[model samples]
Target chain A: MTTAVLQERTHYLNNGYGLKSWLLTKDHKRIAVLYFITISIFFALGGVFASLIRLELVTPAGDLVSSETYNKLFTMHGVIMVFFFLIPSVPATMGNFFLPMMIGARDLAFPKINLLSWYLLIAGGGFAIFAMMAGGVDTGWTFYTPYSTTYSNTYVIATALGIFIAGFSSILTGLNFIVTVHRMRAPGMTWFKMPLFVWANYATGVIQVLGTPVIAVTLVLVFCERVFHIGIFDPALGGDPVLFQHLFWFYSHPAVYIMVLPAMGVISELVSTFSRKPIFGYPFVAFSSVAIAVIGFLVWGHHLFVSGQSLYAGLVFSFLSYFVAIPSAIKVFNWTATLYKGSISYATPMLYAFGFIGLFTIGGLTGLFVAALGIDVHVTDTYFVIAHFHYVMVGGTVMAYLGGVHYWWPKMTGRMYPEGWAKLSALFIFVGFNLTFFPQFILGYLGMPRRYHAYPPEFQVLHVASTAGATVLAVGYILPAIYLAWSLRYGPVAGSNPWGATGLEWATPSPPPTHNFDRIPVVTHEAYDYTAVPQEVEVV
Target chain B: MSSEAHAHAEETLALREQFDTAEQQKDASTLGMWIFLITEIMFFGGMFAAYTIYRSAYPTVFAVASSSLNVTIGAINTCVLLLSSFTMVMAVRAGQMGKRNMIIIFLILTLIFGCIFLGVKAYEWNEKYVEHHMPGQAAFHLEGTPLQGPAKIFFSLYFAMTGLHALHMVVGVGILLTLIVQTRAKKFSAEYFTPIDISGLYWHFVDVIWIFLFPLLYLIDRHLPK
Candidate 1:
């Protein structure tokens, strides 16, 4: 298939060529690109922290560094990975770029506020960097009470403040997306007919708006306790530390959905496009996103099952946790059915999509083990829990993120990355990720507790294997960063509709013009209509 | 055929209109404001949930802590806030009716009431400070109180919850001041009063939060042990 001819259009990139233009720009696409770059840097920094952690664990003894340094390493890793990498990865980048175009709007409802979110992210990132430079915080990302409020000698306040500001950034983004999706749809594009990606983002936006603020307030309380010696979370002064956990997870648990839902949305598009089939049970998939968002809130107490919660309350949380999985299962099954006996392609994006399916399955199934009261008691803080979340968060969300990034790179930058290298990196990531995390599951089941600087000699084999996998995973992650950067200047021009996919974004020029469209499109066909052939001829 | 060409030109001229209709624009903006307000509710909802669980667990301490609160100041603040809401509504109505002077007048009235609310809050907080009721201070004691450790819990929550609410009030006042300036500049008209409407929604929301706080904090221990 040849590239189709589009109308001659003036490029937005050529319209401006200075830093000031980008800094002051209201263009959502540019803002998305800006987010992509900023988040990539933070991800690399976070990966470095992870590498230090894995390296320290390569041996049985705590010979690599003191326990204090090790604690700082994991703390920095968790904080950066959760806040800077996972939460903002897909939504700020892909959602910002495509949501407006998907709904036939020129820009978000409040473009200035949209820009303000970026500034907030930067300010927050700066505080985080400052904390790192000024002897990093050691209170693990959860900032579990007593430790965070009273024990930690590091700059907990600085880090917590950073996260608080970043939380507002997310809230603003959610607010923008909600308004855009609600009010900006093109004529005739009903909610049901909208693409599943939009549906997923909409659900995520809801969680972002509602769930993020709880964590913000919790962090504020933590900060106050630290600075003012307030006894909110300190048991010695009449504060209940358990209450802190309840409040923290109330947001953090749904935050996991905030991290994954967008990736799931990305997977829906990739599955349908590559399989050449309309998504099986589209409404189920769409509603499941909403269901997950709502159900996600009720089950946060599952994190407190072993934390001295009332037995009855624990049971309630445990049961609610099981119910949450039903919607997730529906999503996985629908994706599988979408791929059933269709004209399948082994494109790079599809490979990553396939990776997402396999890895997310392992990650999600293991979550059930942790949710079960008896099982969670045995492995609550062990490597088992670590492996379970990494499988879901890193293996699942990150794979889908890379897939979406590759899938949209052509449209986003008007350049195609090297397909062969892309496929090779995808394979390496799968192998390396499995190597790094899969053995942790064994180590966890064998009673190796997480967050320790030292361990018994018996766990060394799995530890070494995990460390080796981290090195490969590091390479796997770095390769795309190199090639994607290289592709921007030297690769062949990606004309509009590089993948021959069906979405409103594909209907416009690659690296879309500032106003998005010369005229708003009137939608007459449903999304993912890949079965029909086109009559228009290629320009090239 | 030439006559038909003239009719076609007339229709074509009308086809390139922006925004489908006025109602469409209004609906979109209104929906956007409501979604934003929902986010605000969620923001405060977190604090409320925390307050609820803690208060339920220690009803006696919460009541004793409530008894210490100056009901006169709190009630006055509440009335001031409710009246501010009324003034804000009138301001929005003035904007809608294209009455610029009335809009400014009511907005100013709303600002005054807001200041009055903050003033009462300051006096109440000062009273707590003077009485050594503030958390983490050396003056905190519960020997004679109905609830032992729970009184401290009550005061801890009391400061955190009301302090956060006061912080929001300050923010709202700043926003209203901005609206006042913008109103003076003639930025809003009958056709474009989104700012006023959204601000009113937010002001009313803050008022609603105080309503919940009053019952939870001020009225929880009104009938204390004699």
Candidate 2:
């Protein structure tokens, strides 16, 4: 009731409202909302591309499109999902909106630079869309040499440049978040007391800061090779094609953490809130985020295990890959343990959280399968690999993202959607996701390679199942879009602290004021110390 | 609680009580700078890792490639960048002293030295082009050269590493020019020169990257027969 009055009084919309207000706004929340809209559009575009891929894969043959079109389909899917959707999904949207608020800061360390990051993202997204319109890239997202450098007739330069600019956006966002989290916390908020989401984002920020630039330079090299025929990774000019894989995966392998670590953070909050418990092993979970980020960098060579890497190096990377799993396993065990003996409620967010736990477990275990050198040799570049990553990227990351969106939707927009439909969509997504990707694991195990436009007739049954599942997945995904938009206009008005969560963000009004705080909060208690019974206050 | 009264009182105060002391601000900024520098190290670290792998693979080619690089020009550029780092440090010191003129002078000096570094780099690149040593072109060859294919890899990496470093240097110069303009406006002083301090960190980082680049690209494996 008090916060409701505050919300009505302190509107976040710029006083001088215009295109320039939105465009030139230095507020982090405004920029975050900017990122939210842009990433959603890209996600829809990428979803369309994904659906086309699934439709074609429904049968063993590439029946829906030509080989050239199929190549472009998967390539567009990979490029858009990776650069546009997954990498920026959680961090730029939710992290930007919440990190400063969680830490009791008015804004990120550099607000103008924050705005610049959004612009860069838009410019990059624009370039990517332009590339798609210009008959799309077909070299897969990896852009492996000679094919990318010499053979491809598609718009390689535009796509690579898009990724390059997007990389800078990631770099700047990481820098701002890192600085804000480290420097801008309230007086009593110690590092240990900070929420696990912050810790996870801190780790994600580290990877972004450290890894994005390497990819930026690598993409620039790919661009240069395509434009000027410079032989950085091209084999025809005596370049080592494998080296491109090394350099690309060096950033890209850790990039997997960049995509997942933030989602792990979101799950930490959801599990704790819905289960009504302080996260089990909060310190371990916090440190594990950092540990995963650190060890994730060392294990990139695992991607190159079958890429003709040195035998000794492959073994070293394999061991490191196993080491990286320890931190992830700690997180998974901690989440499960948090749910044990706790009053777990199956809200929409909680259902998706459960989905995340199950799917991410399968994804993580399959990751171990690929991390082991011998098994990797058997399944590298197969549909198994495809399934493994989709489980992590799609099943794990997207589920957590949707869950987070639902969990935070009331806070972000001051309205609550129909909970029943939200839960149904969660179930649909989980079942549809498994149906769509699980068969690929078997297909891949049975010696089917990925990236091919066609396949043997024997795989048709599995393919058809996958296509049917994809149709379900499309519904699962589109429902959220429809409902969330509807909720913006007509859903029940949510009070502050609707979830009864313990964090500074919920301490403020729903859809917080522009400066974020009318008066800066003095955070005296630890994050997520939700041990007391809930208190209900009437709306004003 | 009246809005006008609150606004008048808050605006009139020279500093807010949110930060208990100036030291906290300094500490936070310093920590932020250190974290940022760590990222810069990782950025250059990627390039250095690539160089090491290729250099080990084609030691002879790398050696010839190193020798072919205009070491004299690189050395000069190195000194110019190093000196610019010194000037940048001095600029920060001037800001600390509230000496606007001295800050402007030091920034301009840093900018000049940055231009000189890029100028030398362009000259060296042109020389490589003339010698038919640029990677991926018809003029490029390691035939009769000891390392052969690896040698081509060496030049490819060399161009990439140094070329990227040079681009950063150019960017640093542009940043310095902006700082110079801001300094002339007297926007920064003893109390607030965060822009200069931040730029100094970036400048030092660029310098440090070249410090590693010089040894890794220009000095490594330079003794092998061509």
Candidate 3:
């Protein structure tokens, strides 16, 4: 369909008006918007905390705020960003909006449950926000034992409860995705015929379903130990603190995949579509997602290596951790190979994809460094670890998230953001993100531990550099928020397939109808069969 | 059958707008429930892992604490839950048979047994409270054993596991009550009983959790001397 025909059509956005239509709607597309709005608030809140944290670290002394406030700042930052923003970032927003459309389904299999997942996130986030406003939780986002269960004078229970409730939200979304992929695929859309994005999401769903409940129960144990003195993780009452680490990271390590795998899926799409080629080694990339989810489980013990976890167990864990990297490496190599000799474009989304590849490599490599018992002992609690995850989460996940958002913006909103501004922001984020995090690797190697409000004067230069990059990153993030909103009202109307992409979602009108397709599509081509896709003339 | 008649029958099947056919709807509902149950397993699995670890650490305390639980009431509650599971199946069968009255009767029966099990659980907990076996309470005291402190751990696990199970039972009761209302409203038929089937799956899963809870919480080291 042309842009003229699309202008007269009633899409999901115009389907209903007013708050009630949105708040009570069962449509997956509406629910995704609800998630987008909610997580955006959370992202802004998390970003504020990050800015405060960076500002504090810019000096050698903790002069800006008390140590306690600083502690709460980072804690809330970690909690909100990981649980509320990053984990749900791509999956809940882009994944939710597009998964059904890609699979040629009208909506997710469980639309009510899909809506309920959004509400659960709000309710869970409400408890967390309540905790934050009501004195704030300072036990750190990990909620390690003794401090969390026995000694911390904060809202540990409220925060943990919030996360506990949100775990169900993740589980429900995962459940919806799994069932949708299994039962709602269009005719002839076999498992392999589905996009890698769906496969990655399906893998993420498996982790969410299997792993989230453990953390939910772990948080419950933390709650019981704190309130009722259950003594599961409290060492004073014959409980093992190390067990808390085991249980926490069991879900949490896989949860790292939960955060990154969906981004990898997005990267897959961005790389292939922008490169004008099919994914290289599709089965390998597809299975690597499942591989990461499974191997991701066995490596949690690596977190406990310096914590008196048995030497043999640590050895086993360290080995398994290395194994997890192989699949990740396979994906990186495959994406790079997909780009080889292919007709590559420098779209804003493709730039983000390049950023994801470069930063995720650094993140994944540092993960291996930490996975090794010898290296982990040196830098386990240092700025190196912080830099490592920020590289993955902020660098990898956030970059791909933006890339996917930009790539699919037209399909989602029927408007193309200003190309020049979009590229400028992407450049700002790329340059800014690297500047912000890379110096931390040096400071960490020089022996600066994380979560400290003050540091020696020698670390100030690196901290200042890091803080400067953060300012630029902030500007980078803010740009999209401005332009995307602007584009919604004033940007050029986007035709159905702006990128000439090869997914079912793009086959429909921009801002697809409430029923998604006029008639259910039948898949007759391989994924990213760009040869059959008529190549549009390059708009220079 | 005429195409219009078949289409009307399909509509009467109550196939949701999302599903293409009744079988697809049935499959999706059943699959969704099974996946949810897997999550439930991991939820309880976390506690069970803690239990196994702590039990191994303090076998004597766990044995003593296990003995202190009222076996008679525990056994009786087990029987009650088993009977409830039976009634739940009967309700699902009634659903499939399209016996509206039988479905309601069986659901009510199952709900009653669920309540009876909970009522017995409350009585047992009250008895423990009187006996000072309740951990974390100021009056909690276990006399004459080196395992006194660890016995608190046992009681903590006891309350945690049983309390969580009881919470599930409460939710199960709520679900059954909703099914009862829906049944009364004449929502199910021979061709459309997916909700009833999935609810039965959930109820039975709760019952199965109790089956494990019964032996692990109540019957552990019962053969040991007092």
Candidate 4:
């Protein structure tokens, strides 16, 4: 297969022309591409702030930027990365592209709403970007009240409005997925017969539907307090600031699962396909995603443990937090078991899958330590918490995201990226990620607090080490951006099933037609049925 | 299927391209609406949770502030919303029975009733404003309470919740207007009345929320005004 063949037929790309077609497109795949470009810009913007934060932290004093600037830098990094980048990272792009096709459907249930979701995210991001340009907001992404509601002089209202508007984007996507999965499955594609990725997204949809609105209303209150002096969270006006934490964490915590669940789903497919076996304990794996979402809600209280909550409440929350790890541990064990006694191939996606398993495990275990009352008291506001989430987020979700992109890049663009370069970047990410955050664990345990630009001279070595690793990680991240874009123009044309995967998505051309399929497919076999797909082996 | 047959089905049922059958499209839209309503619940639930915590914290102050509401007007608004809900049900029934004129009539009735509810709400808000009970105002005070702080908190929540519910009613009225236009345009029939049905569900859902809100916010003390 080659580039000449791509011009012969009209897929989603060639069937349409100009910005009008793309901007007005209701096609899920095109929307995914739009989301991909939009979120990538956001990622790079966040990375620039992260770089400045790292540069400032390298020395014992805040030399690169003022302490206030440092505060804005880290806050913007967390805000943009969490909301604009990670929350919509996997689900908006990959899930949007693949979930419908994987379920053997023509498109999502509501394409207009899907497009509306993208626009909402853009509108929201526009507000955040506006706030950033107009001298950045200093309130952290958490936006604890009194500081946010009473004291802060930054663009809290603009940023909070951005998040509030974007939250509807998430809710609409969730509602679309819930309706689509329930109603759009092809004739024989029963709930049990669906791909694990779809299952992963379905669970994510549940969380987005059930959890996001609380944050939306919470932001509304914050905005009201800031503008109208509503005093819902102002202690001076007979309001409890701690109640803000309760409301904020109520949605923000499960929001972690909202970011990670789709990543886990992507890994399930990657691991099973590369290992060439059905994922072991399929039912358990499927149910665990839902269990994690359900239990994820109850454990938001763990975040409030060190916030002067009741001692008994802390105990209850700590215990429930431990239960969330059970489902997570179940998923890890199941993935490991799926890899056992199988023809394992370490493709780029598989490398990311392996990295995701290791990092998410470490992230999840450290999660338990923080969930503990006494340990949370020790490390509540330290660099340890920062390192812990970076491991889960950057190490777990970002790795899985990059891996899924590599795996699907061919199918999406009708071109294969330079596999050798992809492999190199994956390795760089794996090694650089560890070097960046592992020292932060030690620094945190040694009592280095987070969000502070200046630190004691004793912490300089670890900070310097972390800074060095960040430089490496940046290179690792930039390589794919260059190579993947390069591949779109000049790389070899991809075949229908470049990876020999066995999902409905791979049954179409590399870049599928506007309607996705000439005829709707009927599923008869179980998911990850290696024997049903033709026998082939391609290692990159 | 042939293009002619497809065109005929499109003319009659207006099936969407993504759905394979008319029934599936209907089910999907209904489920989508229900899920959307669920998100709306969670949105209101956040404020309700905050209100619950505050109410428990300032029971006596909250009771006095609750009494500050005009219970008679509140009771009248409740009846108007309930009547609007009844008209919405009749509109949906007319939709099922394919009574185009009847659907239009009932939706108009629902709209008028919703407007009446909103009008009374506006008058009540004006009364609060004139009485200086609005939160954040320097002159703000409830006549029967010296605990000015908790009273402000109570008014803050009162305006927030009812204001949010009124916003939903405004949206419902907009939807009603659209439905009336569509009915006049003959876009719906007995065979396809989902837009009307789901709009009815939404109208009723708003009504139910008020049913809860009226008791919680306006009838907390339930003593007759002197």
Best by DockQ: 4
Location of the lowest summed lDDT over 10 successive residues in candidate 3 chain A = A531-540
- TM-score quality measure for candidate 2: 0.93
Native contacts recovered, each model? 0.47, 0.32, 0.76, 0.78
Candidate 4 Cα deviation (angstroms), residue A2: 3.0
DockQ of 1: 0.43
- Per-residue C-alpha lDDT of model 2 across residues A432-465, encoded as one tens digit per residue: 9999999999999998899886899998888888
Q: Order the candidates by TM-score, highest first.
A: 4, 3, 1, 2
Q: Tens-digit lDDT track for model 3 on A328-423? A: 999999999999998899999999999999999999999999999999999989999999999999999999999998999888888889999999
After superposition, candidate 4 runs with Cα above 4 Å error: B1-5, B223-226
Collision pairs in model 2: none
Report the lDDT tens digits of candidate 4 across residue range A22-140: 99999999999999999999999999999999999989987889988988999999999999999999999999999999988889999999999999999999999999999999988
Off by over 4 Å in 3: A1-7, A537-540, B1-10
lDDT of 2 by residue, B1-226 (tens): 3456545534542222323334555655666677767766766676677677666766666776677677787888888889999999999999999899999999989988888888888888888888878766776765447545567667777787788788878888889989989878767768777778888998898888888888877886565343
Off by over 4 Å in 2: A1-7, A13-17, A537-540, B1-33, B141-149, B220-226
Scored against the native two-chain complex, candidate 4 gets a DockQ of 0.84
* lDDT to native, each model: 0.85, 0.84, 0.91, 0.92
DockQ of each: 0.43, 0.41, 0.80, 0.84
Interface RMSD of each: 2.9, 2.9, 0.9, 0.7
